[model samples]
Target: MNKHFLWFFLLFCLGAAAKSLKCITCHLHTQPDRCRRGFGVCIAQKHESCMILQIFQDKALQLTYMVCQQFCRDLTFDFNNRTYVHKCCDYSYCNYDM
Candidate 1:
C-alpha cells in the first residue's frame, strides 16, 4: 500500500509539471534584443499555444507582438499595402525568437 501511494504521488507531480506552458511576449516597432514587453505563463482555460505576429510595410518591419493563443494558425493578409504574418507554436518560449 505504501509503495502504491508513493507511485501515485510521483505520477501526480509529473503530471502537474507537464501541464505548464511558458511563452515569451513582446510588442515592438522593430526586432529587439529581448522581449521588452515581458514573458508570461499561459493560463487561458482553452488556449494552449503561443503566437508571434509581424506586420511589414514597404518591406520594412512595422509591428510585432507575442501572446498566448487558443490555436496557432499560419495566416497572412494585407491591408493598406502592409502585409501581416502570424506564426504559432505549442512549446515553452517558442515565440522567443520572433
Candidate 2:
C-alpha cells in the first residue's frame, strides 16, 4: 500500500511539472512579453470589437476566403477559432462593427 501511494504521488507531481512547462513553451512562442494572461496578446477594444480584430491578426489576408478549406476551420462572420475575422479601426464619425 505504501509503495503504490508513493508511486501515485510522484506521478501526480511529474504531471503537474510537465503541464507548467508546456504552458511556458506555448506562451513564449504565441504571446508577447509583459503578459498578464501569461500566454496571449493583450488587445484593448470595446467588448464587441475584440473578437473581430483578433481574427485578422491570426488569419491575415486569408480572411477573405471563407470557404472553410482544410487549413481554415470554424468560420464565422465575426469570429474564427476564437479569433476575429476582420480588422478594427478607430475612425471619427464612423462606428462600423468590423
Candidate 3:
C-alpha cells in the first residue's frame, strides 16, 4: 500500500507539471502594446510550443498574435494576397520575443 501511494504521488506531480504550458497571447490590432491581452495557459493535447503569428496585408502589418500549439515549425501561407507568417518556440512565455 505504501509503494502504491508513493507511485501515485509521483505520477500526480509529473502529470501536473506536464499539464499546461503558459503563454502570452495578444493581437496587435486589438491590443497594440501586445501585452494588454494578458496571458493564457494551454492544456490542449499534444501542445508543446508557444507560437507568435503575424499577418500582413500588401506588405503592411495587419495583425500579430500568439498561441499555444502542438507543432513548432515556422511557416507562411497566403490568402487573398495577404501573407500569414508564424514563428514558434518551446519554453514558457517564448512568444514575447516575436
Candidate 4:
C-alpha cells in the first residue's frame, strides 16, 4: 500500500542520485600525449573514481595513464629520478582533460 509505494519512491530517488562516472583508458608508448595501446572508456562503480597517472622524467612528460580506479588517491611523489602524479575525479569523463 502506501508504505510500499514510499519505499519504491525512495529507492528510485537514491538510484537517480548515485550516478556512475566514466573515465578514459590509455596504455601507450612514449609518443608525448596519446593513447596508443589500450584506448577505451570505463564506468566507475561503487567506491571508484576516475583517475589519471602521469609520469615525468627530468621535467619532461614521459607517459600518461588513465582509468577508473577503486580507492583512488591524489598525490605526487618522485622515485628513481622520475616524478609520478595521481589525480582522481568523481565526474563523468573527467580524466579526459588531464
Candidate 5:
C-alpha cells in the first residue's frame, strides 16, 4: 500500500508540473521571418493555449501573429482572396511557426 501511494503521489506531481504553458508572443511580424514588435513570452492561463494566426494573400505569406489565447481552435478561412489560419496547441511553443 505504501509503495503504490508513493508512486501515485509522484505521478500526480509530475502531471501538475507539466500543465504550465509557455508561448511566444509577437505582434508586428516582419517579412524576413522575425518578430518586429511585442515580442516576448506569455504564461498561459487556465484553459488557454499557444496560438498562431497567419494571413496569406495570393498564396503568399502576408502576416504572422502569435500569442497565448483562451478558447482557441484550429481552423482556416478565406475572405476577399485572403486566407486566414488559426491554430492552437497545448505544448510549449508549439505554435511558434506552425
Candidate 6:
C-alpha cells in the first residue's frame, strides 16, 4: 500500500510540473521592455518554442488558459465556442491561437 501511494504521489507531481514548462529558449532572450502579445507576434520576434504539454484527455471539447507573465496571459481553444483565458503563471499562457 505504501509503495502504491508513493507512486501515485510522484505521478501527480510530474503531471502538474509538465503542464507549466517554460519557453525560456524563446521568451527569455526577448527584450524585457517590449509589450509582446501572444506568441510574441507584436514584437517582430519569431519564436516557436511555445508549447502546450499534455492537455488532451478524451473526445470531449474544452477551453483552457495559461498564465503568460506578470502582466499578460494566454488563451486556448477546443470544439467549444468559449474563450479560455489563462494567467501568466500557467504553462499554456504563452501558447498562440490556432
TM-score of each predicted structure versus truth: 0.68, 0.23, 0.61, 0.77, 0.78, 0.30
Candidate 2 residue pairs in clash (backbone atoms < 3 Å): 51-84, 54-84, 55-84
Clash count, candidate 6: 9
Who wins the TM-score comparison?
Answer: 5
lDDT of 5: 0.90
The segments of candidate 5 whose C-alpha lies over 4 angstroms from its true place after superposition are 1-19
State, as a TM-score between 0 and 1, how close model 2 is to the true structure. 0.23
**Model 2: lDDT of residue 60:** 48
Tens-digit lDDT track for model 5 on 1-98? 69999999999988976777989999878576789889998989998999999999998888899999999899999999999999999888887858
- Cα lDDT tens digits, model 4, 1-98, are 69999999999987875665778888663545457888898978889999988899999989888899999999999999999999999898899887
All models, RMSD in angstroms = 3.2, 15.3, 3.9, 4.1, 4.6, 15.3
TM-score for candidate 1, residues paired by index = 0.68
Residue by residue across 11-77, what tens digits does model 1's lDDT show?
A: 9998977777777666553543545555454543465588888988897877788878776788989
Residues 42-98 of candidate 3: C-alpha lDDT, one tens digit per residue: 643474688888888888887777777776789999989999999988767777767
Q: All models: lDDT?
A: 0.74, 0.31, 0.73, 0.86, 0.90, 0.38
Question: Per-prediction count of colliding residue pairs?
Answer: 0, 3, 0, 0, 0, 9
- In terms of TM-score, how similar is model 6 to the real structure? 0.30
Q: Whose lDDT is higher: candidate 1's or candidate 6's?
A: 1
Could you arrange the candidates by TM-score from highest to lowest? 5, 4, 1, 3, 6, 2
Indicate whether candidate 3 or candidate 6 has the larger lDDT. 3
Per residue, candidate 2 scores C-alpha lDDT tens digits across 1-98 of 69999999999998865533111101212223232332332222232212221234445432221111112223346443444443333222111122
Where does model 4 exceed 4 Å of error?
1-18, 29-33
Q: For residue 37, what is the lDDT in candidate 4? A: 82
Candidate 4: global Cα-lDDT?
0.86
